[model samples]
Structures are given as C-alpha cells and as structure tokens.
Target: YAKTSRTELLHFTVGGKDAGWMDKRAFTATLDKATYSKMSRGAKIGDAAVSSKHGLYTKPNNTAEDGEKIGLGSLYANQNVQIIQSAKLSTGVT
Candidate 1:
C-alpha cells in the first residue's frame, strides 16, 4: 500500500510586524499494490496533478454586529484575508 502525507507551515508578517503562523496538513488514502502500480506507470517525470479545497473569509471583530462575520474574532480591524500557497513535488522512487 502507498500512502502520502504533507504538512505546510507558514509565518506571516504585516506592516513589518509579526502576524502569525498558519499550519496545514493533508493526507491521501492508502493505495493498494495494483492501483499504486497503475498510477506509477502512468506518471512521468515533470507530470503534475493537483487536489485542493479552500476558502476565504472575513473574521469578525468587536465592532461587528450579530451575523456580521463568518468566524470568530476579526483580524486587526476587519481585513478580509486568504492564504497564499505554493507546492513542490519530490519523488523517492528510483
């Protein structure tokens, strides 16, 4: 069986001040030998695939009235924000 897992940690700053860090983890289901072999045979160097699910939201602040924001407290005065991401692939098969 083949299983894949990945983790991403990011540190961010705003206006030269430390904002916070975002940590994310992703996992893929284990593949049996036959499925893994088929996938491996079809894939080639430099080939790529992507899978993702994400959202952007405005965090509420103390000034916000009821039902004004999506999640918990606001971000330094109600700034709408989303995470920016990049990906790199590494292979261990030889």
Candidate 2:
C-alpha cells in the first residue's frame, strides 16, 4: 500500500472527475440519516458543523426539476479533515 502523510497533497475525485485538492490524511465517513440532518441544520459533530437550506435525499430515477442540478453537500464528507480548495462537483458518472 502507498503510505500517505498529513502534509501530502492529493487530488480528490468523484466518478473519475477531479473535484479538488485535499490533504492525504483527509477522508470522509458515512453518518446516519439523523446525524446528517443535524449537520445540515447547523449541528456540530464534535468541533465540525454544517448548515444548508436543503435536506439530503435520493430520488431514484428522478430527473432534475426546473433545471436544478443534483447537489453534493459540502459537508457530505467529514468536516474535520476537509482541506479542499477550488472544490468542484462531480457528475458521478464513470
């Protein structure tokens, strides 16, 4: 396995597209729906917090309404390790 350091810079990708730069030590975790909702509502997980006007949901086979693109939450990843710069959204197609 390749070893990574906290200072190492790496490209973050989603579905083969470049998202942004992130520290090698940075990563994300899946939280329960309740925790996710809380974070979206300005709740903190430890010292990290997030706030958004919309709720996270999945509409399977759902098309975008009113030309609204699907959203990827800024806090979808763990806030503690996020060091992203010039972050970009992914189409999530591979």
**Which candidate ranks first by lDDT, i.e. highest?**
2
lDDT of each: 0.31, 0.39
Off by over 4 Å in 2: 1-6, 28-94
Model 1 reaches what TM-score against the true structure? 0.19
- Write the residue-wise lDDT of candidate 1 on 1-94 in tens digits: 2223654655667899997765523323232221122121222222122111212124212222222344322222233334233222223221
Q: What residue pairs clash in candidate 1, if any at all?
A: 60-74
28-60, model 2: which lDDT tens digit per residue?
Answer: 533222211112234322322343433333431
Lowest summed lDDT over 10 consecutive residues: which window, candidate 1?
Answer: 47-56
Q: What TM-score would every model get versus the actual structure?
A: 0.19, 0.21
Instruction: Give lDDT: candidate 1, residue 68.
Output: 36
